[model samples]
Target: MKLVFVHDGPIFEDKDGQYYEYSYHGLYERYKYLADEITFIMRVYPVEKDTKGTKLPAEIKVINVPNFKSPSSYFLKKRIAEKNIEKQIRETDYAVLRESSCAKIALKYCKKYNKPYIYECVGCIWDGLWNHSLLGKLMAPSSFIIEKKIIKNAPYVYYVTDQFLQRRYPTKGKSIGCSNVVIDKVDESVLKKRLDKISGYHVDNKIKIGTAAALDVRYKGQEYVIKAIKKLVEQGYDLEYYLAGGNRKQSTFLKDLAVSLGVEKRVIFCGSLDAAEMPHFYDSLDIYIQPSKQEGLPRSVIEAMSRGCPVLGTKIAGIPELIEQKCLFKKGSVSAVTNSIVYILHSDLEKISIYNFQKAKKYTKEILADRRRHFYDQFLEEYRY
Candidate 1:
């Protein structure tokens, strides 16, 4: 059977120096392993393929729909994406969507073409937006209505965040847990011994706590990390902070904050790196963190855990699921986050990091493939599609 995945854009969002988009690549990585016959109905855009260029699997197909404009004109562009998407679906056995806009279009195609479609949404976008502005809170009711409609309509509904599903709707989808949690940690090519030795770097030393995400101030909790770093410095902890991802806007703001904290030498702004090369950055960490106020199964957490890095993060949206019993604090509390980091850092975290890596095994590419295939199998068995 043929399967098609729809997305807002073909490439991830790039800020001044940091690239912050997550859901698309994470989902693509997971789904690419599961489905043999697939088509990418994406918003074609320009991107940098490494100097060596990209190598895509033969099972995947690309079909760009130019109707993708900015969020402001989504309705008009959506119609265009939907217009051609319907044509592609005529031969496909199944269609999957990443978010609400795509879900609505996929919903329509399923209704019109008599094809079975699934909503592969990660979590509640409306609630995530509520972290950024009052507008998101205002939009939540409509988002709820639309989410409910999409969930009820789909033959299969898979989510990336279990907390989101449980809080917003009943847990009745085929593969009910967080569908995929991506981390660029396990590259069999690299020597495992290098990553396995976490104690050599962090034990009673001037540790560097790192986080990789777009410099955007709102969603990423960059400010909170900086504030926590300042608090740690005040407590006489010899440490430097690595703020790896940020664009011009975010970098400028953070640079100023670092100077204001008078810890300018301690904070480093290492701009965006190619997605494939992120594993190197993950390997160098003494302590890893992401204090995001809201997240959908953070890929960074998965990556850090893969390197056997003990992650200290906020207990937000889907994050608590992966960091289950790891290290966490109340969301937005710099003091709480600082304490958690200090506690984790003082101990010999090599064994803890090993445990973290072992836990991450459950969400591997092979595991995701099995889950997706079985989800399709169960749905088909229940109703011959």
Candidate 2:
């Protein structure tokens, strides 16, 4: 079978003609058995000097579209992109659409061509856009309405969050909850080391707090954590903050923000780390916080949990499903973040680490792979008939 996979995320191509994507490392591998030939339809850009991502397999085909910088740019390039996407959809045997603006366009062609497709509803478009910026806020409502309608009508839908997304965008057709995050394995030693670190922690020792997310997106809420660090420092608590992910430009912007906020010394920018290096990054941290104002069952939180690092995140989307209610704080509230950190510090850190480690085991690669395969097997069976 020939499959056309569509997503709005940009893919980068190096001078050597190699393609790279930040979050798509093992994603295409899942469909290897389902599709005889796979073509990815996404925006393609030249690789930046400081950019980091997993290299794409040479066997996979890519159909590049313009990387629109804004709504106006998207509009300017819409006609040409639509013509190309329509042709691909018409030629493809099946479609797998990851929720995005580009996916919305592809869906129209899929229907027009009578192509069978599955929808991957990863995050809430409303929260994602509303929390993004002034322009995104203005686009949020209409985009939400469009995406909700898209999901509602999809014959097969897979949501990353168990209940949050399903409830918010209830579908009348067949659906299942499955996270895209796939933990290769959880080492027993990781939990033991975390427990030992927690037990050895002292009030006088500087607590290390870290978050792994792209710095370019403000909705990831790294600034809120920086504010919390400043407040905690004012209260005489020893603390250090580490931020991972982003290009050179985004890093400089954040570094400037840290300097202005008087937490430059406490905040460390680690730039972007490869997938293999992420486990070590989580291990080095005393606490992992996902301060995102928007998310769809954040992979970083689960990765952190696998390393037995105690986590704190906002009480939004699928976050509550991952951690105990006590660890959650209000989104975008610096004071609430400040209080949550203090509460976790005063609570039983060892117990939290153990709980997180055990919870992470549920998301191991073997378990999720089985679920995904079952879904795709059913999809292929239906398509074949």
Candidate 3:
């Protein structure tokens, strides 16, 4: 049977016809295991394929809708995008509406065609808007209402962040809490290298703390991480902070903040790193922090955990579900974050690293794939078109 996936991300095809999607290639991997053929319906805009972007799988077919890249042209093109989405829904056997504002068009077509669809709830856009701009805040109430309606209408639901999204938007449908954070098996040599680093940990040595995210986004709390490090530094702590992801444009604001705080020398902005190179980056860290003000579930934090790095994050969204309670603190509290870091470092590095790695195993591709397959089977068994 054919599965149609709907979301708001834009994918670009390069000169070589290589598919490049930023932060959203995991969708291709997720559906590849569950369906014979898959159609991804999204807002696609073209870009010159430099050697940089990730390639999409061949088994998947892409249906491009209006990306609405130009603000002035949005409304006119959006109507056309709706038509394209309707045509695809008419052809596909089943639909998977990955929750995004873009899916409203697909939702309309699904209802009109009497098509069976499942809603995959990843996060709450309303709560997430606090990190975004004024436009997002102004649009949040309606977005929340529309999201609630969309999920309520679906015959089945799958949630990535179990507690937060499910609690806020309860639905009367078959539901499963399977996170989309997929990781391959951690290399044995990498795990051994992590152990060696911890074994040599000493009190006076410089500590390397790192976090990964698109830093330009205010809510990722890259600034707060720098502040937390500054607080620790004033108290006679010798540590350095490394920020991964985001380009020079995104780092401009953050870099200025580091300079003002006089921690510019201590903060290292490593720009963007590819997925393959991440494990080594995680291995270099003594402590990994994800100090975001909001999230569904953070894939980067889990990546660090899989690499046997001790993790600390703010108590927000689905973070508490991933790591121990002691590893979390009040959201946006610089002191609480500083205190948690100090506590984790003093408590037990080796023990926490072991616990984290073991916990990360549950999120491996093999384990999560089985869960996703079971969910798909149950849905197909219950509601077949």
Q: Which candidate wins on lDDT? A: 2
Tens-digit per-residue lDDT, 231-318, candidate 1: 8878888888887664455588788988898888988887766456667787777778888877767778887777667787787777
Across 1-385, the per-residue lDDT of candidate 3 in tens digits comes to: 7789999876767666666665674777677555678998886655532224466777779887877646899888887887788888998778888777567778888889888888888877787775688887898898888788777767789998768888877788888888888798756666677888999997568999999988768888888878888898998889999998866777999899889999999999887776777877998899999998888888998899999999999888889988988899887788888888889888788888888898888898888888888988897787664
Candidate 2 per-residue lDDT, tens place, 240-274, comes to 99998887788787788789989999999887787
Give the residue spans of candidate 3 off by over 4 A: 45-51, 69-71, 186-190
Cα-based lDDT at residue 159, candidate 1: 72
**Best-to-worst ranking by TM-score:** 2, 3, 1
Candidate that scores best on TM-score: 2
- lDDT, candidate 2, residue 67? 60
Winner on lDDT between 2 and 3 is: 2
Ranking of models by lDDT: 2, 3, 1
Question: What is candidate 1's local distance difference test score?
Answer: 0.68
- Relative to the true structure, candidate 3 reaches a TM of 0.92
Give per-residue lDDT, candidate 2, residue 381.
Answer: 81
- Which 10 residues in a row give candidate 1 its minimum summed lDDT? 47-56
TM-score of each: 0.81, 0.97, 0.92
